[model samples]
Target: MASSRPKNAPFLFPTFNSSVLPDPSRFFSHDLLSAPLPTNSFFQNFTLKNGDQAEYFHPYIIKSSESSISISYPSLSHNSAFIYEAFNADITISGSDEPDQHSRKTHLISSFSDLGVTLDFPSSNLRFFLVRGSPFVTCSVSSGNSSIKISTIHAVLSFTGNSSSTKYTAKLNNNQTWLIYASSPINLVNDGGSSINCGGGFSGIIRIAVLPDSNPDFESILDRFSCCYPISGDADFTKPFALEYKWEK
Candidate 1:
């Protein structure tokens, strides 16, 4: 005879172990880029336009957690040189059991994540993550018969400490070298009561140029970020720069 179970009797089945399942959080907690070196890191100090001082660290690390991508710095109280802007993209999931659930979601993105590059300073125990956002550099390239213009962002990580040199260099992928020069005077007072100029800027005016040796057509590179950074009238790509940093003084 078949056994009859009570209406509220607990169903007996094989014990499923959730430990064997893949952890979704682990996927987000991984490092996006890392290059370990000695503890002797290189850093520079700069005064903000509002009269506040901050330190910039080179050879930094980029790590992503469940919520945001963090650019690790030596000091937690350091001020950011440039404005930090967060972007969002809409993601649609097609194959979902429920029509309302998982239909769409907004994903947060970093402006510098797409064009970020890592560089190592020779003889220094540091690796710098060079990245930037809006106020993009518009490049005018001459093709066979037409001129193509592309807007992209790049960062000036450090300067070649030459007393007589004013040009700052940034090396990108495929052996591309970018030149950065101060368009305006950068005056900052350090803690030592000395005025410093002609170094790096936490937030100052500078000009950028792409060498002819590097690839002028950044269409392929920009295509990779089409979803995150759409070229629309309201998008950051259309603006020269956005100042999100507020100073009290």
Candidate 2:
């Protein structure tokens, strides 16, 4: 009898050696060679206690700075109303590869760290830093309030359909879900005698929040999220490049 599996079918379990992995630097631009690569992160829409909601569509980058972690929305327009509403929060991950026999799953632990916000407008070549307060996520600009403490917790990332049209969630260890909302943008003043509207390119803001475990109407809130970013490719995973790997015992 002949095997029924398709010749093009992906391996049930694919493994690769370190040498087989592509260099990360090749994905970055030449000018950025001197700079550190950005961490690709995602956010979704979140609702407030007052029935207010904010939406996010495109992926953002989280860059580490000397004093804080800067979250940049590279696709948003500089004039977007939700610019200032983007703030920053600390994120610490702790987990091992070992899986739990009972749950049959490996968990990723996440915790809060001291954080601040930085907004970058590449088109306008402008940058802003917020050290006071955020409209969404609860965080402090200073060393962070020691009185308010969020215990070490675990989070899970939930994917919906396609990668671009998916929801990236951070569920707490107690099974509570949190949200990071980016509200409307605020007016910018010409402090440096430069026109604030000089740049017509995309703008990036940093604002986020974690919803309380009390639970809000997530079903309705998620519906309000609109995708502002453009989808270039089909709704399927890209085909992998042809490569051969030798399995070792």
Candidate 3:
């Protein structure tokens, strides 16, 4: 079954060799050119699992669990020094620490199972997910051109039943404008918390994929989703940085 997924959230994805990825056009309508990142001066900030405070942040993508793993980016404005906002300028990110405020490199990455947000590591059975910091503040797609590669991503896991400490890793695809594959059913509460649905003494790996926004293949998946389930929300809006942490047993 399909669950509500944010188009821009950082999601844990698995590489599927399957030649079959349903078309996405049926499920999505908002195009990138029609909706650009917010250009307004006002900023919005949703608290993140991390203790650091922020005003305008966005988790461009969250991992696969219903738990919200936000990837936040600072807002775009002329006053912000990190970004050169003039027309025809290339996008950029920076690090700053002037004592009055806290700043770090534009990239921010954390896993729900690692943050101690929910379960204590010693008591939980979940293996940590190794990933790069999220919302790396360097991504932009020209209005006329619909394709862009933000960066390469990776994830690692060891099966729950496996006794060996060995873990498997995969590099995620960066072609799509937006995509999310949840290997399991996860619930996303309005407040950005989550619970997993692994039950009945059954535990196995699940794989999901988000095809590139430009891929003709995405249109097919979206089409099926629309016919069976209507798509809601403007696909182009940036999801605010959210609260999510995990515990395994």
Candidate 4:
């Protein structure tokens, strides 16, 4: 499928370049690239000493930073915000068909809380994006205290075929806030499904605003960006998150 590009700045998606990307099939994964990116391309990437890597992406740009893995790209607009919340679900016990079979899913999300960044904006003209061209499913680890901490440090998408959309709601006095509805959503490669072998590695970057909300009902950006995840339910991780609001407007 062709990448449906974003507009410069519109009511819904008004904070990015409007160039349409070539068919996703035409884009090659980094594992296949044998050398540096073309001088004029829009894709950019950085790999850390410990092998941690993320990409700096424009509509047509691609890059590979093999030595600098810790740097991050800040928001480009005054009304931008960036947020990342993830939980590493580890299994303490495997489920078996036997009567005594046991299984337990423990949330490892909070254990690595210090790995994320929270940027604040004064007003609500927010635009957010998950940058790297694709989502992650498998990554080889060499840094962090142990080898299993690869995706844990970067908030890489869950490899278990789980897609989650979260809604955050709050209540406020009489006012109107449309940041959530007005913001942009980057529809990235879905579910990490193709299993293209690249040393079990993938990269992604998300963009958010830190400016003030043009509409006043929302006092702080966090109030709207915070998400609520259910502790437990007989539900698959495939949940389409709708918005939840406290109602200031």
Residue-level lDDT of model 2, residues 1-249, one tens digit each, is 986779988555333445633444432335555644334322111111211122232233433221223333332335645553352222321111222234312111111112222322222222323222222322221211111112222333331122331233344444444443222222221222211111111223222434433256653444254222111112222447644322111
Give the number of the best model, judged by TM-score: 2
Best lDDT among the predictions, by candidate number? 2
After TM-score superposition, what is the CA distance of residue 178 in candidate 3 from its true location, in Å? 7.5
* Alpha-carbon local distance difference test for all models: 0.27, 0.28, 0.24, 0.21
lDDT of 3 by residue, 137-239 (tens): 2111112111111122221111122122111112222222322222223221111111112222212222222333346556456434321211111222244
| Candidate 4 residue lDDT tens string, 49-144 | 221223343211211111111222222433346554222111111111121123111111110011111111111111112232211111112222
Clash tally, candidates in order:
3, 12, 35, 41
Candidate 2 residue spans exceeding 4 A from truth: 1-67, 70-163, 180-207, 214-249
Error of 1 at 99 (Å): 39
Better of 3 and 4 by lDDT: 3
RMSD of each: 22.1, 21.7, 24.3, 21.2
Q: Per-residue error at 182 for model 2, in Å?
A: 9.2
- Model 4 regions lying over 4 Å from their true place: 1-42, 47-166, 169-249
RMSD (CA, Å), candidate 2 to true, equals 21.7
Question: Model 1: residues >4 Å from true position, as ranges?
Answer: 1-165, 185-203, 214-249
Q: For candidate 1, write residues 1-249 as lDDT tens digits.
A: 865777888766544446543322211112422322112222111111211112232222333222112232222333467554232111100111122233122111111223332322111111223343422222111112211111112222332322333334444333444444432233222222111222232222233344435454653343233223211121234446763322110
